[model samples]
Target: MALRQISDAICDHLAQPEPARPLVLSLHGPPGVGKSMFHLLAAHALYNRQPDRPGLRCPGLDCAGYKVLYGMDYTADERAAQHSALRAALLDHVRHAPESLLVVEEYDKLDCPMRGFFRQLLENGPVANATLNKAIVVLESNLGYTELHDLLLRAGDRSKIAPEEAQRVLKDMVFSRWLAEGCEERSDTMKMVGMVSFFLPFFPLERRHIRQLFEMRLAERGAELQNGQLGALQWDEAVIDFLTEKVDFEGDFPIEGAKEVATLMTRYASRPLRLWAAAQQQQLAAQQQAAKKGGGSDGGSSSGGVAAAGRLRVADGGMELTVEPAKALS
Candidate 1:
């Protein structure tokens, strides 16, 4: 819901008249909590529509006016070169399309010099050979996550914490942390922080949220049975419960959120399907052999037998896996 709200805000900004200041957004969240995905989704939403139409282009090309940079991938030794390249690329894109969106991921990992460059852009409302006053800039980082978690815990209910309150608390925490890291009071990083138009905090997902994500993934994989046919593979409720329990038992809550649960499910779910498929094959072989030996009267049942034998069912009750004989194709 927070993601959707943030997406809506970006969309609203896109629909507005060109303003003097670029829409600078800062996304703060822990790892694997969908911050990167959010950026990709926002790009797709903004630039992927009717790309070949006039004044629209695909984001993969240099002229598309959408750029994504990863801070961690560039180090201090190459900072100057990377900074020049970044400036050139950004200016080129903005020159082509004044309403461009520049996304910088792992913003906290950027060196002070690069941070200063960004600070200059934000302060001046433009960059080399381009006016970014009508563009949108997104900076994503994991900074202030622990402090945010503490704030949420103190509130006892995330919903009870107003958005303004969360943003204020996070801003103070980020500023304090920057100061503690030997940054000057008027450091570039702090200036950039002060210039952010919006501070979107992505909270750690709960068990229910993780379960919903798993269900969505399953739906995407067509993992559902329909009309007594193998329309899609389905997960048993017991298995889901087992996965949830295992996730709960894992040490820190929301350390990796849905990502960790998805990984666990992927690791554990495949073996059962393999075993089940093997058992089904074995059963079909036995049934065919019995039929050939005149053990059953219906020879035409082999087609139905194939369908029935191909059914693979996996269930885990109380962490105990139960593999039964194949049922109908349903």
Candidate 2:
């Protein structure tokens, strides 16, 4: 649902002229539920320049047009000063990167005044005469996390939860929290909150999602080793399962989601992979040296160098690196 809404918003925004206001979205969920990752993925998809593609020069968070501000970076003690700097920076960013992405993480942490700045920016449609209607603005918060988490826990299956019911629960929680924190009286807060075009909720990731994340991280790690001229380190599905199982879970969902997956990977998987790659490289080098010496001493040559192939797996309650002949990959 979140993906569909975001895709539709992007497609519509790109297909038409500048909108009257920026594409404002509010993402609410618990920590480690991919709220922050959403902005990163969106930037990569929109800005990663490919052959015959129309995009920014860089990809993902590397793009100059992608701006992220953390709430913790600003304090109430310096709200006045920070507000000046923020306003100037935002105005400058919009003026330069008309078609841009701006993500504010932990947005609810910002003081009422700071949020009011965004309220004006999103409401008035212009900043210092520069229009922001070409940008995609995302505000990320964990405001309704408890409510959503409870709902997910009750439903057991995420698909069983009604979309409208989830939205209503999240929206109401977020609005109520914001109203209490931001406004003294019930005045005009809804006007600012209503500026958000979509309220996207990131549900807790399931085990399958956790497994997929492990695969992606492992694949990237493999590429890193290959690029460094190390021997290939291959793994079977069992290794992925092993790593995925190492993650702690709460009920049907991962406790930390992708947050702890990296640490767990490094602790459990990285050392084994590194050792395997290094050992394989050393063994291959020794074999090649022996082959070269044999060819020179005897007036005979051998076929191609021995191909070193190994598979990493979980066997006998421990990590097993098995060297074997390369077979056709399924």
Candidate 3:
């Protein structure tokens, strides 16, 4: 996977000894293409394995250690203070845990000066009292989407595009924007572009990829068929097909990606399970009351009848509920 490759690259970079430049990565892609997920997974790969090791911290998406600076969120008046706070926080985190990962969201929205501050940290080893010499920096943006899409199309196959070629294309596309038109002076953003070690492109997810993601999410949520004390839950192909086809319909839009698909599935799938769970709980309570009133053991086990009476059916181009045995576990 591209994420694993990127994680491995970061790991390899971290293994180096006092490298002159920090390992900087620029993730360019459309929205909902999993840039944030990549950051989380990469952190897990780097520090989660042995978290207690001195100076080894898996900040991941932790609000404390893993710092995310949103460019568009800060107003002009707040920008300076935000930058100061960001710098202080970054230094503090790195001082305590040098392996911290810094993620900058909406990189294109940041003012030139703010971008320059980050550039300084990348170019020079230490900023203020903290050294990011071993830290990993990821800047995520959708700035180069058109160019990147064109590059991949011209290559005929995205996977066929060499890393060096992809890097060169990304650098040209990203830095060109940083350099103001008809201006000889290069901005700090342009300088930061030069410091990037890898330009990881998150390709738009395909329908099949969305299907896989749906299945994975289903497994995570424990939405699977259970039969007579079955140990493992079985997923029905029908439900997977229903959600995948729904997502596939919305995939034509440029911004419609995994996030939208996941949202849709959650909305449609989660409700039925929730309803069934509530019904099952009520039935169980009723059964407990009956047992307390001298009912047989069968009364307690009959609670599953409520859930068994719930069925998931696709109708009118969406999921509709009916009263039947629900083969799936909640």
Candidate 4:
């Protein structure tokens, strides 16, 4: 549902004959439920035709047309300076790349003044003669996570939660939060809230999602191996299952979602493969040195001719990664 809404919003914004205002979206959810990942993948999709391969290599803040701002980075002591800097940067960004993406993470952490800044920006009003009409603004916040989680618990399936209910609940929660957090000017805040095109709720990730994340991380690890000319890392469903079980779950959902996936993959999957690759490279180098000094193979094939593939599996009640040398051609 979130994906569909975001895609439609993007397409509609791009198709606009004369875009009156920027497409502003408010993403509400718990931590680690793929809110950040979703925006990154969305940004990648907009800029390039590359498949959404899981890894941290997405063209996010580095992209010319994409900008990300963290609310926490704006310290209270330097609030005025930080706010001006942010305002200037955003103005410049929109002027340079009209059709762009701007993601504000930790939106809930921004103080009343900063909230006012965003409120002004989202109004589509003139800002030094520059407007955000052609930009897509995403405000990521954890404001309505409790409501979202409760809805998920009741619904069982995330898709079971009605979009209308989700939007109503999340928007009400966000508005109430802003009020409680001192959104000084009530009328302006209300107008800012009304300008948002969509309030997408990301629910807790189920076991299936976590399993898919594990597979993606493993695939990314394999890509790393292949890119390094270390053949590939092989794993079956058993390996995936083993890694999936490593995540801690509460009820039907993972406690931490996919947050710890990278750490777990590095420790259990990527580390052993990396060690093997390093050892294999060292051995191949030694063999090449020996061959150069009259230590040639009897079969006339170079000792370094074979590349090894690392295979991971469940073995002896634990995990095992074994490197196998490729067969030489006849």
Candidate 5:
């Protein structure tokens, strides 16, 4: 669902004059699915908040938060530090805030029943230091239902999982772990004494969507920007078509040709850079040999050099930033 739609539902629940379920909106999805951007936009649209401030907190755990001291390997001590850091961050956010909409980017970083306790907190916001606070917790985890379950099997990270059966295996593993840890059972029996739990669906990637995403990015990036609606970038139509043709739309692999084009453009940013790098590379060794024989380097040439050069060089005076009157006739 769109962020607004979901937020509206949460708002409806809040407008209950009394809320049965406090606003815990879980913006979950695998990376590259635009979840983070959505999280930012949602926070802005709903809470009038920026991530840098305290009014809204949607923290993502980095290696530091994981307490892996700079270049040190992951150890129990480091994990302990990370755990402590995470708990403190969560508690701090919940303790004092006008609107508590916590988006925990990687909730799965927590160990064992830590997830269970956190989930319980989500389903039942508890009292801290004798004060009552109505807070919402969104646990962002890629483990999904099955992977989390699969993790509990042998008490190790390595789960005997098949590629195809990954989802089911994960679900069962997490479910089993929750059951074993007595969290699911306890939460169910006690009617969730802390916070509410909600799962955001993992989005499927599509090439068309990726292309559109690039266009939007291009629009946002100054390659093209007109109005609120993103228009096609100023790239050559032929080049755009050529790119779309090479990009695999049906191969199931997540390939983004437009992004490749953007990178190519970025690398070929300067005239000398493009000439020495790309345009010159296309001239071929045979051409170089021919050029050497002819005394300089323009060797066994391919007329395609123009096209390669064109990739970097725009028309000489065709596209200028500041326009001058037709120079009043030479």
Candidate 6:
């Protein structure tokens, strides 16, 4: 529901031309709810022809031509440089430039005061000389459900602002952003929404979607998926159920936990070194025992069970058998 809700909002918002066909959508959600994926889908919906029909118009930005700079920690120089670069890139991407939409995921890093810089560009209308071309901007937020209330309050939002201590911090920030030295006013509602901030409501991510994310990632890696191939790698119904139980069906996931598991797998047992390592380590102890006796090689152990019972060898005069304890060694 979280992604679908976002998709629906973007599609519906731009369905009609709201002046210059400007459709600026801002989405706020917790991590792992597929916000990026939803944005890609929304882009496709903008100018896409149904697969059932050919010679279709797929309305969306060419991602290769687009530059998506994640606004995270940046020095002032880094921020300014990237900001200018992004604007320049956008102008170049949209040739004869039909309005290209810029989806700024995690936009809070671009302080609210400087937000008006964007406001001015959109509201005043980009000049032919300006770096930005005719483009709609979609500014997404990192505000998770828990963080939304605080952020809205920080943005001078009063009606739904909570009364918590965290809420107080947001309220103070809002005051700073709104009343601060750098903040500017915008008379244009559409431009304000695009350049500044807006709210995106939350929805539940059903259990099916959670599993789908993993499958989707694997598929992108060229893993051929059978009906149960997704289940084969590190998860099954039991695991999914156990995971779903911890999630807030509204798509807010145990993101930390997921990262932890992926980290553990990568660090300990990821591909090119899984059971083979464990088996090799296990064989080491057996090899030492055989070395003490010193008849069979480090790997060849006929004392153990079937594993040590290596393959059979046939000679001209008689039949002799040799067994390899470790299949990896064999």
Model 5 stretches astray by more than 4 angstroms: 2-5, 16-21, 26-28, 49-74, 130-133, 144-197, 221-233, 241-250, 253-330
lDDT, model 4: 0.77
Of candidates 3 and 2, the better by TM-score = 2
Model 1 alpha-carbon drift over 4 Å, by segment: 49-59, 72-76, 179-191, 219-236, 248-252, 274-330
**Candidate 4: worst 10 consecutive residues by lDDT?**
321-330
> Which ten residues in a row are the worst by lDDT in model 6?
306-315
Clashes of each: 0, 0, 0, 0, 21, 9
> What TM-score would each prediction reach against the true structure?
0.75, 0.82, 0.75, 0.79, 0.52, 0.50
Better of 4 and 5 by TM-score: 4
Model 5 backbone overlap count = 21
Query: How would you encode candidate 6's per-residue C-alpha lDDT over 1-330 as one tens digit per residue?
Result: 234444564556556553443445555555654566555555555445243345533332343323344754467667777666765665565444455656666665665434656666655665445433335566665555455533544545333443343333433343344444344443333335434323453322334556654444434322321221211222234433433444444333344323333443243223322343344446655765766577554566544321221111221343221212223235
TM-score of candidate 3 to 2 decimals: 0.75
Model 3 segments more than 4 A misplaced:
49-64, 72-74, 152-157, 181-184, 187-191, 223-238, 248-254, 278-311, 315-323, 326-330
Q: Candidate 3: deviation at residue 126, Å?
A: 2.7
Candidate of highest lDDT: 4
Model 1 lowest lDDT segment of ten: 223-232
The better-scoring model by lDDT among 5 and 6 is 6
Q: Give the per-residue lDDT of model 2 (tens digit) for 1-330.
A: 677778898889878685777888888877888787778778877776443345534433358788988764565688688788888888898898898898888877877777777777887877687777889998898777678788888888777887677778877876787887845355667787677788887887778898888888877876776665654557778777777777898865787767878887777776767676777567667776887776743656452244454455665656543323235333
lDDT of 4 by residue, 1-330 (tens): 788888888998989977989899999887888788888777877777355455534454445787888754565688888888878888898888777788989887888777777777778466887778888999998777668879988887787888888999888887787777666767766786798899998887888998889888878877877787677777778877887888898876788877878878776776577776897677768767777677576558675444467676665557554434433211
Candidate 3 per-residue C-alpha lDDT over 228-294 given as tens digits, one digit per residue, 9 for 90 to 100 = 2112323466777777766534333335667767676667777765565556557657766776566
Please state every model's RMSD to the true fold in angstroms. 6.0, 4.6, 5.6, 4.9, 14.5, 14.1
Against the reference, the lDDT scores of all candidates come to 0.66, 0.74, 0.66, 0.77, 0.42, 0.45
Best-to-worst ranking by lDDT: 4, 2, 1, 3, 6, 5
lDDT of 1 by residue, 14-101 (tens): 7778776788888887777788877666666776554336754445763366777865457658867988887777667788888877
**Residue-wise C-alpha lDDT for candidate 5, range 75-111, written one tens digit per residue:** 6767667666756655665555524555656644455
lDDT of 4 at 121: 73
Q: In model 4, what is the error at residue 245, expressed in angstroms?
A: 3.1
Model 5 alpha-carbon miss at residue 238, Å: 3.6
